[model samples]
Target: MMKKYTIENNYIKLVTIDYGAAIHQLITKDKNGNDVNVVISFEDLESYKHNPTYLGASVGRFAGRINKDGYTINGKHYSVYTKNDVHLHGGKEGFSFKTWKMESISEGENPSIKFSYSSNDMEEGYPGNLQVSVTYTIVENQLSIVFDATTDQDTIVNLTNHNYYNLSGEGSILDHELLINAESILTKDSDAIPTGKYTSVANTYFDFREKREIGSTYEFKGIDDTYVLKENNPLATIYSKKTGIEMVVTSNQPGVVIYTPETMDENKISNKPLGKYPSICFETEKFSDGPNQKDFPSTLLKKGDIYKNETYLTFNIK
Candidate 1:
């Protein structure tokens, strides 16, 4: 069974569900003082259950792709669930399809809800019994997601939320201005798997160091690259001139995967069909295929050790 939980402050209203511990809605006032939902979401639980795009779900165990060869720790090789020469987002079922337990909820100036799940040993072909918790807290106009986990055996973890945001609340995101405080991005092969190398964004279309429209580049297709973040506090910012809503994204992770799909299958939001490039996602997590890349930041979670990732999205009316 699935359940929804809501928390609000003076500036925003948020809705979350136990299935996938997903974010269902985030409503904020626009410049016109009218309500708008900044995140793309479905209208019912049935649609979410078939969420091929991941939607506002929490993806985990390993958030991104791992080479089809799998990974090793302490000289022991482990095979993971994979398809088409890659292991993605834990596995076919992954954390996004799990039903988490609602642990707690609170109401106040800063309301919050916590959801937990325990992954069994070798579930999805990953070793160890892992205990994971995701807490969503609303403080004023900002929403903070904190992911914490512990494994009873040596395992790997990279958890993150997959929320598609459209600050204007409707239409394509090409008109949105974007900025990312990063100088380089992970180089990937034809299969979209990182090749353990970094490419400078200078003199390239991948550069977002300065605020600019996402469609400024010629023949703009879409973005699905991982950016190596700098030490800047706020990792990225995006704004919609139409609604005068701006979002500042901050996180403690080493990198962020920015994805802008060219099109989505027929999915409805607010009784309207979601069209092409309706939103963008900033997935803050450790480097992709970290366990396989020796130089990338490790995603290894040793026994008895805790793993934590925190990300914040602060909204304001510009």
Candidate 2:
């Protein structure tokens, strides 16, 4: 069973559920004054229980992959759950797969909903009694997400929301135009884990410094890369020519992972399979494998210290 909490303003209507604290609906009007749900979601809670795609769920402990040999804290190496070698999005049973407690819900002005969860030490091979909270606040045409956490012991933390967005509310995102305030993207191995190196997007398909259709260069290859953000303005902007709706994304995090799965398997969890390139995820967070990379932004959380991150998704008509 799923419990839903909702908050809306004249410009948007947001509905989120306790299961995975997943966003069930985000109603916003297109340029033509037609309402559309801009995020991908399942109609039933059971689909979320078996969600193959993260959808609009909050991921945690560590937002991206951790190399084969996890990380060391105070010279003590710790092992984490891994697929073949990489430790992915926390683990098999990550935070997105669990139910969160409703901490509070407010329905005026800046309407919002807060959800909390506690992770036990060694759960999924992470070391810490972690307390996590996520707040979703909706205003006129913006949705702000605040992620906060604290641990009882030294641990690594990097949380991010995985929202698959389609500004037009339908069809392949390939038709959308995008702009990323990023000069380069992390170079990755075949497995999609950064190799601690970066490549400039100056003349490559990775470049999004100027607004362009997503299918212009990378076409069928799609993308699953982390971009090193430029100076502190909105990190990225995406627009749909069809609906004339635009989304400006800003975050305090240093990197943003953009992904579009290579294939869309409708047989995974739903009878209706989302076609290829259905949506794209803009995951803002610390650099991937941050705990292991000394040069990347640190993901360390000391005992008694607080961890906080915020991302703003503002909508507009263009």
Candidate 3:
């Protein structure tokens, strides 16, 4: 018996888990008053198990990269689990793949599902017995995600939900326009690890200071740049010139990694016309590669401290 929470408003609907994957689908009318499933989903556990890219899964333990999978914490060196010669998204078997304990915070009227998990000391090669909770709520046209955590020992923690979206609920989003309210970005090496340099978004393809078509320069390869946002405001807009719909992202996280399905090789559910580049992901969270880089923001959770973060995705039309 898998758990699913279905939420809707006048123009759209978002579905998530009584577990973790945020299978958000925008249910809207297509020219006619005909309702269609414009969103994508693996929906079942079997698909999520085989899809190494996480499909529409949440990212955690750590959401991005760590240098050499080795780093020092409080004058002591800790070697985290490795991937591509580095540590990516926690480690080998991070929390995203696990089933969280779920509880309904309210019985009716915009209810939310709370997911809690505990990571014991040195679990996945990191320190601390961290207890974390993430709540998902849908009210009006907004899908809000709230994350909280507490730990008994010092350890690095970064969490973010990875959901791909296409505002028009249409075909490839390569022509969709985007605007990021960021002034700078953390530079990275070819392997996508930060080079310890924070540079301006000026005159570079890194600039999304204004609306730009995702396809205009997409041939230069996909963007996974970590933008140093204006504030803890992790909001950006994607407007589908094809449909008049716009999707807005708001978060307390300091950075966002906007990515298209440039690396997608997964199957789309039949009856839907989805190409490889249909959707885009807005991964909102703390700076990437923090554990190894002293210059990056610290993600250490002190003993008895509360970690709280909020990210909301709202929808509307132009």
Candidate 4:
């Protein structure tokens, strides 16, 4: 039988994976601090094939774009294929788009669904035979994701999830209050690429030093940018000012990419309500090309090495 989990009691419609790292559910709420089912999804395997948005999908091989389709490492330039003039999330056939092998159990401390995959040498222009395992765990109102990866050759990798959250359990997150622990903002050149320079968030749209409404900031017009997370801290949070709901995002990674989904042309995804700024993603990962950038941390691994990345999302309503 396929592996799955349930927390059903007229509150949630929970589904797990015996295939990959995707959780399906409809989260509604009641007065007694309980969440109910409100999001519709396919009850069986057939419906998932067409589900785009990767909706709640586990992404990897690299979670963001690689500018100009390539980067250099150790004085060597490695070229990548251009998708729509730029390299997109793992070159179109990334892990998110694949059906992964899975394993499960019901009575563990924190029940989990593990998805494992391997990328051969030069897959997506990256070098290595990477063995990746993404495990999702839900415990005491918090969802913790642990990513374990090992590569036989040197390669670049970043992984994250694309989960749309509405603390109000409503449409759109424009009215949400977000606080990013950032002192200076990353200055980007054209094409939204980081310029390897920084600017103070003070007196600018990038400032989130205080708890401010996200939409209240004018620079939030659907532009996706990266922020080098403030050091000395392990987590950042966003709380809904109206519903009193809070989401804390914690990661061990060095940077976070805040993507206001409105940046994508709606038509590009077809006529669906899914294409707007209804959500924001705080993707935690290493700096893009950190291996090549003289100032950024090096992302290199030789054989017999182990690498790990972790992120946590905790939710509560006040």
- Candidate that scores best on TM-score: 1
- Arranged by TM-score, best first: 1, 2, 3, 4
Two-way TM-score contest, 1 vs 3, winner: 1
> What is candidate 4's TM-score against the reference?
0.82
Give the C-alpha miss distance for residue 271 in model 4, angstroms.
15
- Clash count, one per candidate: 0, 1, 0, 2
The estimated TM-scores of all candidates read: 0.97, 0.95, 0.89, 0.82
**Which residues of candidate 3, in runs, are more than 4 Å off?**
9-12, 18-21, 24-39, 105-108, 217-220, 231-234, 266-271
When summed lDDT is taken over every stretch of 10 residues in candidate 3, the lowest stretch is 263-272
**Which candidate has the highest lDDT of all?**
1
- For model 2, the local distance difference test gives 0.86
In candidate 4, where is summed lDDT lowest over 10 consecutive residues?
A: 263-272
Q: What does candidate 4's lDDT look like per residue over 130-241, in tens digits?
A: 9988776666566667788899876777777656555555455678788888787566666555667877878876677887877785666663666777852544678765
- For candidate 4, give the lDDT: 0.64
* lDDT, each prediction: 0.90, 0.86, 0.72, 0.64
- lDDT of model 3 at position 217: 60
lDDT of 2 at 266: 48
Question: Per-residue lDDT tens digits of candidate 1, residues 33-72?
Answer: 9988998878777678888789999998899999888889
